[model samples]
Target: MYRPLLRLLPALLVMLASASVLAEEVQVAVAANFTAPMKLIAADFEKDTGHKTVLSFGATGKFYAQITNGAPFDVFLAADTETPAKLEKEGAAVSGSSFTYATGRLVLWSAKPGVVDDKGAALLRGEFKHLAIAAPKLAPYGAAAIETMTKVGLLPSLEPKLVQGESIGQTFSMIASGNAELGFVALSQVFEDGKIKSGSAWVVPTNLHSPIRQDAVLLTRAKNNQAAVQLVAYLKTEKAKNVIRSFGYEP
Candidate 1:
């Protein structure tokens, strides 16, 4: 019996070795606005495929510059379609590897109740000392915020009171820390379970800006990486889509 058990142990060891070989660790550069949902999606993907995703989150424009300069990222999830498309054109990304993963919505959010209204009249009222928004040149949501303000005829008046964040995540942090009374942010950052989690928010209308089509692409460096390929495909799965939707993105 001891001899037979020993024989079985060898087979088990071989199986374990094969499983280890199948697992891959992938490095991903993700948009700051997609942080929460990406965390959930990464967890689910790892559980389902035994693959690991290491994430770096920041402004999409910065990621674009990094990828162009040979950053060691396997994939890029950008806040807007244009950057990914540009990467593809510049040969930094694999040709035809880009696709829209989610459509984002902009929202006016205030940590304090009643500070923001459904129609976003608060911006016109000049009630807040500092209004935080992402830097328009570096972030898609920031550009959208500017577009919204321009459409609503509030840009000039609000410009003086604006506080700029390098990324949407920082913008959210500012509002959460009470550094800014209210500001424009990705709807996903403040939304959960089909509702705004802890703040009064007004969903900005789409007509105010170009559709925020968030796209993902495979970097040319990841062309031969099976783990990177698998992770990209996993993002399109229904499980991942559900998580994205829960975050208020149209996935």
Candidate 2:
């Protein structure tokens, strides 16, 4: 009886080892504007998959620079379609592993309610002294902001009032702190899906500018990583799609 029990013990130990392997953590590089939703999604992902996420949120441009210089990232969630495409083309991202995971919408937001109207043209009118927007070079939302301004015919007129932040997160802080009366931030910062927050905001029309296609790509370095595969599978599910939509992004 003792010898038979010992024989079964080896199989049980092997099962335990397999479970530990499935619980490994994956590291991810994501865009700063996704911070809130990523936090929520990561929470759900861990619960569902028995895996962990080590997320780094920042400007896509900076993330790209790091990955190009050997940043140890297993996955990249970029703010723009172009960044992911570039990485794939350059061989830093696994070919055919890139896809649009979410669509971004920009918003003109103010800490004080009624300061901006539905059209948000008031932002260009400069009723406020300073307007905080992310650097167009670093953030897709910032590029959208610039294009929106140009389309509204305010680009030339409102140049002086513009104050660029390093990333959309900084832009949100500037407006939230009232350091800038109004700013261009991701719609997620001002709204949760259909729920609008306190403050006047214009959900910048997607047709007003180039579509902000947020793309996700598995890094070439993660080609053989099971954790990374788990993350990609988890993120493409209905559960992840709902989480992304809850943050005012189009899933």
Candidate 3:
């Protein structure tokens, strides 16, 4: 028994040394709309690669401002393609490292069982006092919401009832908390395993608004960080894509 234990010690030490050398921590700034899926992905990434992720979720516009002002984020996952492209142009992100991570869907949702109709006629009916949406200037989902309302010819009529949230996460919170009876939100927020997890919703047609092509990029600050590179690569993996799809996003 003593001889076996002595023989195993070298292998155990080698394994420990490998783990210590390979493991690293990466800081990521993610869009509010991608929060749920990102959390799951981050967990899986850490488990598989022995790397840790520090995630921060918020409005893409705010993240852009922070990144340009020298925020310490190693990676940026934006809610739209433009922000990442802009960062690349501005030299804040590594050029050619950007790619579309997901295509988001919009939904007209209500926490209550029947407040929202399947066809989303509630907007025209004007039954609710407040309709929450993210601030269009700050969030791609909010801009899509505006476009949908316009396409349905309800913007002018429903403008008075519109309530703006600083980010999509806040808008979802408003609807979930009953502060707004119904609102426009990302499908991922209320969907799970091929259906809305709770409440009622009408999936907004893609034709109603410009496509929401969310993109991810490696930030210049982490250009040489191995963990950052691994994280970006991890997002493109089949495991990550599956998680994204489970959250109702097209990966």
Candidate 4:
């Protein structure tokens, strides 16, 4: 019996060693629009690979500037493909490492019921005093929102009522907190399980704005990090895609 137990101990030790060897922790900077889906994907990634992730959520433009200034994130999930492409050109990210992870949709949302409608006619009614939007210079969702309003001929008419947030997450908070009665926000912020969670929303038509192609890249700081590589690949997996879809993003 002592000999049998000794034999099993060797195998157990090897298994523990393997876990220790594979358990790498990656630091990820993610776009605010992707916050909800990323939380789910990170949990699944860790469970599936025995690795771990530390996540920071913010606007892509700010993250870009931070990475350029030597912020130590291992990976970046940006809200626009162009941002990652620019990072690669600037040598801030691993060459040839960027890929589209999801395409986002913009929505006009209100925390109060009946405050928004499918056609977005509320903007024309002038009933609302404040409208929140992410800053166009700092967030792709905000740029798209501006484009959407311009297409619908509401840009000039609605500019006076606009309130800006640093990021889409902040914009969502503004609307959710009643600081803005209605706003343009990422669909992922308000959507869950294939429907809007609590707010009244008008999913802006895709034709109204350029497609928001979100991309992820392995940062230069993580060029040789196996965990970062695994994470970027994981974002392309079916499991990750499902999570993105659950938040109403196109994966």
By TM-score, who's the top model here?
Answer: 1
What digit string (tens of lDDT, one per residue) describes model 4 on residues 33-143? 999899999999989998889999999999999999999999999999999999999998999999999999999999988999888999889798899999999999999
TM-score list, all predictions: 0.98, 0.93, 0.95, 0.96
Report the C-alpha lDDT of model 2 over 26-112, residue by residue, as the tens digit. 899989888888888888888887888999988988899999999999999999999999999999999999888889888888889
Q: What does candidate 1 score in Cα RMSD to the true structure?
A: 0.9
Stretches of candidate 3 off by over 4 Å are: 1-15
What are the Cα lDDT values of the candidates?
0.93, 0.88, 0.95, 0.93
lDDT of 3 by residue, 110-216 (tens): 99998888888888899879999999999999999999999989899999999999999999999999999999999999999899999999999899999999999
**Candidate 1 per-residue lDDT over residues 1-251, each given as its tens digit:** 59998889989999999999989888999999999999999999899999889999999988888888889999999999999999999998999999999999999999988999999889889988999999999899999999999998989999999999999999999999999999999999989889999979999999999999999999999898888999899999999999999999999
Q: Estimate candidate 4's alpha-carbon lDDT, on a 0 to 1 scale.
A: 0.93
Q: Of the candidates numbered 3 and 4, which has the greater lDDT value? A: 3
By TM-score: ranked, best first: 1, 4, 3, 2
lDDT of 1: 0.93
TM-score, cand. 4: 0.96
Minimum summed lDDT over a 10-residue window in model 2 is located at: 189-198
Model 4, position 19, has a per-residue lDDT of: 84
Model 4 misplacement above 4 A? 7-11
